[model samples]
Target: MKPEFENIPLIKNEEKKRFEIQYNGHFAFIDCKEMSRQIALIHTEAEPELSGTGAAAAVVEKTLMYIENSGKKLLPFCPYVFAFIKKHPEWKRIVDEKFEGYNQL
Candidate 1:
């Protein structure tokens, strides 16, 4: 059966260098580093209880949207983020080309 993910809010906590969300009363986050022209998605994690609930996907999707709207490129340092971009080629438009091996990463 498919699991329904709640519409949890995401926070771009620049000071903490991460995008955050609260899920199942626990904190989930995507670690990141923002540079002058790009943002590097370094890691992603969700509370164990929130696993398989779509919290990670939700955070990544919203983070990608935010990066697109901000007109900045993406540096998917996180394997999960890279995989997400590979699956959604449309998002590749915002990715930096120099990271030539993005798919291999």
Candidate 2:
């Protein structure tokens, strides 16, 4: 069976080394490095203060989407990212084969 994936809008910011997907002014960021990929769930202090809304999940989703769409591999060094991949088996194909041990993290 396939799991349901929610539709979220992701904002790409290549200059910041991240691709941000925002919702209700809160966002998740995927930091891309030349060597590896990292995901972070972050919130800002603005009109709507979103301090820890599990935005990281969206980041993970966006990263996986980007990897799949671009034929790139993901090396998730972030613990949150590692867990996201572990929980979502459907996204495993985008994960780097070298990251097989990510389940342990």
Candidate 3:
């Protein structure tokens, strides 16, 4: 169930507090909030047009890359992100060990 994300631009839009992929005039984004030095992924959404299009996984993968590259830790409160990490265990390294859900991953 891999998503096609290699060509998309993943943007960290701090003004709106999201990591987004703008596609065909709409956005698929991971809404986030900062807690200390950790970024908590709060929600995930895609326009109706992008629903069921693997956009969720695509956005999650890119956001994980952003977190890893920026040397930031992740708190995946969003279910989709949690599931994605559960499926791709390698990304678990970027998650904050103190997160209550970390044991589940």
Top lDDT hit: 3
- Give the Å shift of residue 24 in candidate 2: 2.5
Task: Please give the range of 10 consecutive residues that has the lowest summed lDDT in model 2.
Answer: 39-48
Sorted on lDDT, best first, the list reads 3, 1, 2
Per residue, candidate 2 scores C-alpha lDDT tens digits across 1-105 of 112225666666768767666667555566666443533323211123434555656556766776778766777666667667678777767766666474563
Candidate 1, residues 1-105, lDDT tens digits: the string is 123443566699979889988766876789999998999999998889987777888788888888998899899988888898877788898898887665553
Model 2 clash pairs? none
Candidate 1 RMSD computed on C-alpha atoms after optimal superposition onto the true structure: 2.7
**Residue 79, candidate 3: alpha-carbon lDDT:** 94
Winner by TM-score: 3
Residue-wise C-alpha lDDT for candidate 3, range 1-105, written one tens digit per residue: 344567888998989999999767878999999766788999999988988788878889989988888788999999989998999999999999999988999
Deviation from native of the Cα of residue 83 in model 1, angstroms = 0.8
Please provide the root mean square deviation of candidate 2 (C-alpha atoms, Å).
5.3
Q: What TM-score against the true fold does each predicted structure earn?
A: 0.86, 0.66, 0.90
Please report how far candidate 1 places residue 34 from its true position, in Å: 0.4
- Pairs of residues at least 3 apart in sequence or in different chains that clash in candidate 1: none
TM-score of model 3 relative to the true fold?
Answer: 0.90
